[model samples]
Target: MRKLTIVAIAMMMIVLTACSEGNKNGQGAANDNGKAAAQGQDAKAGEAGSDAKQEPVTLKVLRAGITVTETEFNAYLADAIKEKYPHITLEWVEAPEDVEIEPLITQGTVPDIIIASTTAATSDYERLDLVEDLTPYIEKYGVDLNRLKPVVLDTIKTYSPEGKLSVLPLSLNLPVLFYNKEIFDKFGVSYPKDDQSTWDEVIELGKQVTKQDGGVDFIGFDVNGPRNISTGLDLNILDPATGKSTLTSNPGWLKVFNVLKKSYEVPNYIGADGRYQYANDDDIFFNEQNLGMLAFNLAHLIGPLEELRQQGIELDWDFAPFPNFTENLGTNRSANVHALLVTKTSKHKDEAFQVIANVLSDEVQEKLARTGRIPTIQNEELEKLYGADIPVLQGKKIENIFKTEPRKVIKPHEFESDVRKFVDGAAKRIALEGIDVNTAIREAEDNVNKELQTLQTTR
Candidate 1:
């Protein structure tokens, strides 16, 4: 009986041991299954992440008239774009002189982006319905429009009928009074105050410097054109409400004509044959080096001046704030913005806006400012950095360019370009033909009215 009981006990112990081994094996199998399931999930997640990566896209950028060369575009914008978004490729489409935007659209090749002047934005783009409102994209991207100068924003808004933010100003052209130091020194006339001179004061100073020296004629002052002088007065050529020329009624037009007429009336300014010898262009100031002072576009002159310096042709030159009308003291020329816009037909608007935002980034803006293009943003430090990269602009009083605030821009009429001819003619008749301001204004008004009527009939 004792032997049978021991045998039962041994059998029970063996059964218990087998049960313990089976439980351990089952737990190990469960753990292995859990690990395999986790690994499968991780692999699927990796595939999903790969699929979610952005596809590469090529965005075509049209250069309408902003003077951005391919090399400059690559250096200033394209490379930065690549670093930020490896997916986007910027293709620069340079519009030939004769190539119109309408033809490009009909060819099914509308560009994703356009770089153009503010004037072009108001006229060409508006006429063709090519601009896309960037307000929504600006919100989506958190683009800080507040960083830009208020005048620039105001000018851009004025161009739009509904005040939609269609374009972002990249840079602006501010007029500066460029003077030949040699001419001032020759006449023993004091240099024009950097930011304190008025148009009347400048004209009187021009009288001091206007003389024949060394058998060469030195004109006291000349403007690039009537347009340059008119900008400071915020003169609009046509009244938008009536679609008629404002030359006859706007008192500012009379001031503009008088200023030019006074400058040309300086002694020996008109040639012996009863013709105005000094042309209303930069050639007199830059090449001939005879004109004492020239009110011209600062942004447009930087490249040429830099090139001249590089070629070892240096001029004894300096610049002052653009002379203001006595009544409009402390008012600079109206903002002339060069803007970047996303086209209405663009499929990659988000990406295009990202590009614009990147360009307006502080780093890019600083770099561009160093190259002498005025930044649209209102950073004093950035403004101080102007012309830091150009050897010619070193030690120049570049600060004068920003002394006066830009005037609030008036929206130009569609006929503004057409009307400019009559205004120019009036100025020519007054300066060269010795016509009276009242008579010149009347002639300009009559001619512009006739032209507007013709344009209205044709359209």
Candidate 2:
């Protein structure tokens, strides 16, 4: 009986050992399966992250001036945008001469981005309430405002009373004194001191070169307009607070008008018919090669001049610093920056700002500078790249554009553009009708007050 009992105990021990081995094997299989599942999930997650991309978007861009073309957009800006975003496609909308912005707003086709002059930011966009404050986007996108030129930033801020930054400057339109070397040489007069002459000195030089030769009248000097002259003196046509014309009260306007008179009164500058002979549209200095000195916006002339050169129309021309006012020597003309603004109505505000930020990137700004657009960024190297692409600018006084610092910006009044016509008329009277500066200013003030009254009533 004892032997039988021992055999039974041994059988029970064998059964228990088999059950323990089976449990160990089952736990190993469960752990391997769990690890395999976790690995599979990690692999799937890695694939998703690799394939992720920004959603495709199309942004409408409106270019305000006549200078911006579709081809130039493609060449300078569009490719840079494509390379960075890849998902973004830009649609260029040119502003037509006859068509206005209000109609586009009514049609719900307002552009996502607006590229316009700083003047238009205050006069047109602000008046229409088309722009939005970009401060939030500027902060959210990590944009360093310190990267931009201080004058450019200050000019943009002046447009907004609340100090909202509504625009990002793309390039500058700083004034430059462009001269026809052929005109100076033909008259046997020395060239105006490069970037070192004040307005008074330049005017004196202009008088020396103003003469009749070969039955052609060579005018000594001319400006783009009286508005440009007034701008340099930091003269605003209307007071922002009073909404009244400053033409009569501000002594600066007197200086501005007198400068205009002196510039035109160069002996024999006016035609026999008593008309200002040089129309800017004909580019008298470049095409006619008769004007000795011209104070004009550098950006406006450089590209066109280069194109003329490419067409084999040669004029031995060079530029100097924009001649300064006697009281404001070494001071540049008022800040004139071409800027980009995101519209208030844009649905894709973030993306629009992203595009603008990209446009202001170092790579893009350098490329723009190489193509002859003055960068708004404060980089010495980028400034050196100005006009690098335009072969005609080689060895020319390209640095003269940056030699003078921009004057403090005078915030523009809404009636500034309307009032400019009266000031221009005043300048004409002084030059043509022999009116004194006070009389011209008084006449301009009277006309401007009446026009402002009419504008207020109509609005």
Candidate 3:
């Protein structure tokens, strides 16, 4: 792999996990907004919908998001948005995670406005001509562009074909390699630390540390890779600039396999059920203590920690940047692309635009930071929204992740998550099942490519 590839992986940011409806690429921190909302008072700079409305009118909107089991800040934000503009009755048309949302769009059962990363499957939906290009309306409304972080602005640009943003990105997590301090201390091995490292070193560390403590088998490390193996592909299998999977072709893949598959017979870590299953990436790492080193979405960590905390179970850990594939590939990242798409069907397009404007504001971003979310509207002035004097902007700086870069769309129906699943399954096979590294990669590549090809044929 090129040096840029290493840097990308080492610096890869797992941007989400939370009260989030779907796809938190990073780990979870604290919710600054939840803290604010708990106060039950509106923000001083809350949605300024009245100013934009020429007169009172109900602005109907269609939404595309998961019907979360627990709606934290999301439910509150919905209420706040409605309160900000009483004329705008924001209809949140959420769907189940496993169900396909395209059919609703086809049948005109979709909401007027949509909010979810799933909409990024615009290419698939575009074939159906479902999403409306809101470029002219956006320019006419003159939304507060200055409020957004420049890197986030660029991410929006990636979705837009002609310098027009497609969705309003809200929260993101900067992925980092988290270590269990207690586990490392007990094993008497110093924990890995650096902005980056090579996969070789990570394996060496894992090999030395895999052991049993009080009858519980502990893995030296674990990663929520594509197929469940620790192949570094979970970090960044495809280049953002080029929409191609680089598993079998990259040197990093080899190293990822060698280290993650530390044990040919067993997975690096056990699961919540005590089995080495490759379900929810961060859950196994946090629940079992089966893993010592974990590369996961930052937000994913928070909920597990919260549950453990509630049960009075103590959790110990800290984080570092992902290891570099090669020193020259100075930065590495696992990318998570989240976007907010304006529904052409929205009656209150103008008011919805205003709510989106606030979503990208530093005031709201500060809340994201406290919750351990890297904000889309980061700036020097952005402070933590959870406390009067807390700072949240620093979280973005920690992982070298500044923006939500748009990744090239692989060929599977955009809605298909098979690519992620393929990587997860393939990585685990190579690591635990003693599969030939090259062969495993080829199989995964083939599988992903096949899925992509199938999408094209369907189209």
Task: Compare the candidates by TM-score and give the number of the best one.
Answer: 2
By summed lDDT, the worst window of 10 consecutive residues in model 2 runs over: 1-10
Ranking by TM-score: 2, 1, 3
What would the per-residue lDDT of candidate 3 be over residues 76-195, giving only the tens digit for each residue? 245445545555555445344444666776776755555555334354445455556656545554445555555455555554555445666665444556677778888798877555
How accurate locally, in lDDT, is each candidate? 0.73, 0.72, 0.51
Q: What is the TM-score of each candidate against the true structure?
A: 0.84, 0.85, 0.69
Instruction: Tell me the TM-score of model 2.
Output: 0.85
| Worst-scoring 10-residue span by lDDT in model 1 | 1-10
Q: Which lDDT value does model 1 have at 45?
A: 32
What would the per-residue lDDT of candidate 1 be over residues 299-391, giving only the tens digit for each residue?
545665665665688888888988887777887788788888889899888778877767766555655676667878766766776766566
Model 2 C-alpha lDDT per residue in residues 1-459, reported as the tens digit of each score:
122223322322333333334334542122343334434533443353355457888999887753555545554456667865677788988665234788898899999988877767656887799998889776555566666788877888886647678788878777788888888888788987765577778888988888988998888887656777676788888997788777777898888777777877778887888877363653666667778888877655665566566678767888888877777878868888888888999988877887776666655666566666777766776677676656668889887887888787877667677767888888788878888888988988999999999989987
lDDT of 2 at 138: 67
Question: Which residue segments of model 3 deviate by more than 4 Å?
Answer: 1-76, 79-86, 91-94, 106-108, 118-121, 124-128, 144-147, 226-281, 328-330, 381-429, 442-455
Q: Check candidate 2 and list the clashing pairs.
A: none
Cα RMSD, each candidate: 23.0, 23.1, 9.6
Q: What's the lDDT for residue 15 in model 1?
A: 31
Question: After superposing candidate 1, which stretches have Cα over 4 Å from the reference?
Answer: 1-53, 96-99, 272-280
